[model samples]
Target: MSSSWYRDDTAPPPPLAGEGWGEGVSTSDNPQEERTLSRIASDDAMRPPPQAGEVKTARGQMSRVLRAPLLLALALAATPAHAFIAYVSNEKSNTVSVIDTDSWTVTKTIKVGQRPRGIEFTRDGKFVMVAVGDDDTIQVIDVKTQAVMDSLPSGPDPELFAQDAAGKTLYVANENDNTVTVIDLEKRARLGDIQVGVEPEGMTISPDGKTLINTSETTNMAHFIDTTSRQIVANVLVDARPRFAEFKHDSSELWVSSEIGGTVSVIDPRKHEVIGKVTFEIPGLRKEAIQPVGIGMTRDDKTAFVALGPANRIAVVDVATRKVTKYLLVGQRVWHMAFTPDEKYLLTTNGVSNDVSVIDVAAQKVIKTIQVGELPWGITIAP
Candidate 1:
């Protein structure tokens, strides 16, 4: 595909007319479908589980994939208070594109530091934080102006970061320094740094605000840090190349995706132990290509989505049983993802394909693909 295919614009060229990139047109909405969705939402299991102690559940999950997108509009209507604007970091393009979910279009693009990767919106939704690895600093973007307002003093080669519940403290993973840099978000100054295993890449804080977690890529372990003391209280070793760590909303489990290991290590947050490991299998793809990177789970924690990087698919895992449910084919080299505020939609960054794939949360299908900058990576939505 030509470089022109990746652009920050209102829309890409006509789908059929364009060269090779593919995107789905929005499906027509039916007003009467609201009642039907309500009944589906109320069901104990919208689709029946295969059987008790079933080792494989792909057949049942594949059947539900097509019908999931149809239910999201109704889910959004049920809770109308939360609407979000999504921001995506473009590593090669050195820019961040603002996406308007209502229209599913790129509304604006702001220039930023080179090699921008990890990005997130502040707790108050007033700002966006982007880690520019090459620049060795994290830039702050004002949500109202959509421009770079300031930069935080992150340690060398800062790749990812996590903030506290009150949004007052920031824990940054400095890949080059082998340490997690702590900063005071309010003061915009460095507080201190905690030395950790080499190549620290992922950072996430617990939902209850009691713990902060960092995953070192080379160490293959998730280091649990106590928020108050800023110490590595426990280290739970996981698969190789643990790139991203996420805490379940309920605080019961922490999921880490290992790109090279081709598995997701499911850890019990309370015990700092690996309870189970989730693996993926795609019929035609080689085992080496099944590199899992990003993860997203529903508020109920019933459904978990893992992005299989080079496999070009997202594996749906059953939360209760810790088994692979199904794999939904997406664009190339899928990297990171974020859910709409209402949890009705999930948008994932496809790096090699140079676009963002949208998944309808309820239907569990890739409903749409939006054109973004080259190597679209990190994504976060306003609260």
Candidate 2:
């Protein structure tokens, strides 16, 4: 096994129970209360004015009435605005952990084919598709029932995949065959295959849905393909063992993570060139342990978050400067990450620790750790 794979190949412990399902912790005992008083005009049409002796009692009742709605508004604001479901793929245990974002707990453990990885929610949010490499197929999980319902025809040993903006077409990187298989999502049938480099691992599509990218680990290159012809248009060499690729929302830049090189390559999509690189450094840790595998960027393209595989930290990066702003310590062997629909919280899967770390985006702080399945590899949150 390659030195990088050795770290992930070690026997993982049994899947841990999803615990710590407690109420949201409050930082302060009392929240800031706001009082909004309604105009109380004296009107003979409704009722006569209060007597002088009862004025004080009437004022007290009015105070209580105004405070009630303010308190109710505060309670509603403190609750989570949205409840998003997150699916985590467990590589070793052959299962998926379904987490409810509102409660911050795993509601279900879904048993699936062997070696599940590269999970994503469909555009319609009705189903979740997961690549089970060992089983040589992609399985579909029904969102409502929380069960495996069907399978897709993927190339041999499908690893990572990407779908078009419309979610009608799927491109899967088949590691064993050195090819990318195209599947018709609506029909649930295989369309064709596009040849790529050896051991293709990472997959992504552009925002306009005109181009597709597949990164090869063994070949150490990113192959850009045109969606119209399903042919490679350009090849750009990157650092060693590129494992994941991500594109900006505007399609201006592409980011590829090299696991063994311990760096993230920033590429210009228009020029198809490496424009910059984002590196990570943690005190007292060797460079070899800081292997970056997954990346997540904000919708506005201002900030980015990268998962350093064995370093047990998530590097926060400034997109404009291409510099690491801070490294937040997390669980062991962090693999992948996903953001909630509103981008308030970012969840990361930790393989060795068998848990996921929840980060409050605006605060840049690790807020919660949720225990999940064994060797959690990939994660996807509902839109």
Candidate 3:
């Protein structure tokens, strides 16, 4: 008879039962017992000991992974569905164009006073106010109805205005009078006027809403006015034909762009001195074409975009270094630009082209252009 090695139910049989066919055979163990023992040993090795702490940790990690998607879904649901609206003032047409930001389409055309140059929205986003230079008044429009609601008592040839953060006060720049008319938005009446330089065009308020800056065109100076006292605090001389003024996000510096001078002056608001100047020189571009008109700075104060009117382009400037990085081609006679609420898009009014160019800020390119009335100039985004 032949003998073979086998395992028992509890454990492996001590050793092979047979050697040299029969002489060392163990008669006590059977094949069935050896097989059962082998099976038991295999089960012991495969079974894992339960660990309570490790199981709890694993459960927590899985729950966190599952929550990430749910949180993302909630955030997406909370985001606004509708895009912001932009108001564009058409100089020749004496009309305003309402743009739906989501579709980049013009939704309505509202008639306003003659020579509407500067346009802005109330901080509360309830009304759209426009400065009609020829009409010498500020026309207020109801955003929902797309109709003229009322008019504010602005000084002669009201060109531009700036609103405080609280949306309570508005400072209007009268080009002909060379004065800024202060108005209370709540009352819809003019409070008083502060004398500025010749041809006050661009107006802006500091972040704190304590100081107001007005740029004079022919006088070539930025006049700083204290909002509370309504007095001219500082007058910083700049280049020829200073058109637009913008304050840095932190209100640490002020940027004034000169149209005829083709340069930008960076001024220290506290010291009222020119800290640096930004200039551009591109081959084949005529010096006269690079007339800077509107100025805009990013929220972080890292970048600045200057509109070149005759050049039909925008110059991107590095705020920290005060250097012109690149020039982006835009519509014809690009005048002013208003950034969207999300700061993803920049819509610029093309005066000569009779259209508005939508620029993708991240891509730094014009993605779409929508035709507007003749001589589209001032632009503002509704709150």
Best by lDDT: 2
Against the true structure, candidate 1 reaches a TM-score of: 0.79
lDDT by residue (72-121, candidate 2, tens digit) is 57665775556899999999999999999989999999999999999999
Query: How would the candidate models be sorted by TM-score, starting from the highest?
Result: 2, 3, 1
Pick by TM-score: which candidate is best?
Answer: 2
Summarize candidate 3's per-residue lDDT along 263-344 as a digit string, tens digits.
9999999999999999988679989888998987878899888899979898888899999888888899999999998888
The residue-level lDDT of candidate 3 at 261 comes to: 95
TM-score of each model, in listed order: 0.79, 0.82, 0.79
lDDT of each: 0.86, 0.89, 0.85
For all candidates, the clash counts are: 3, 0, 8
Off-target runs (Cα >4 Å) in candidate 2 are 1-80
Residues 342-364 of candidate 1: C-alpha lDDT, one tens digit per residue: 88999999999989999998898
Clashing pairs in 3: 7-34, 7-35, 8-33, 8-34, 8-36, 8-37, 9-36, 9-37
Which residue ranges in model 3 land beyond 4 Å of their true spot? 1-81
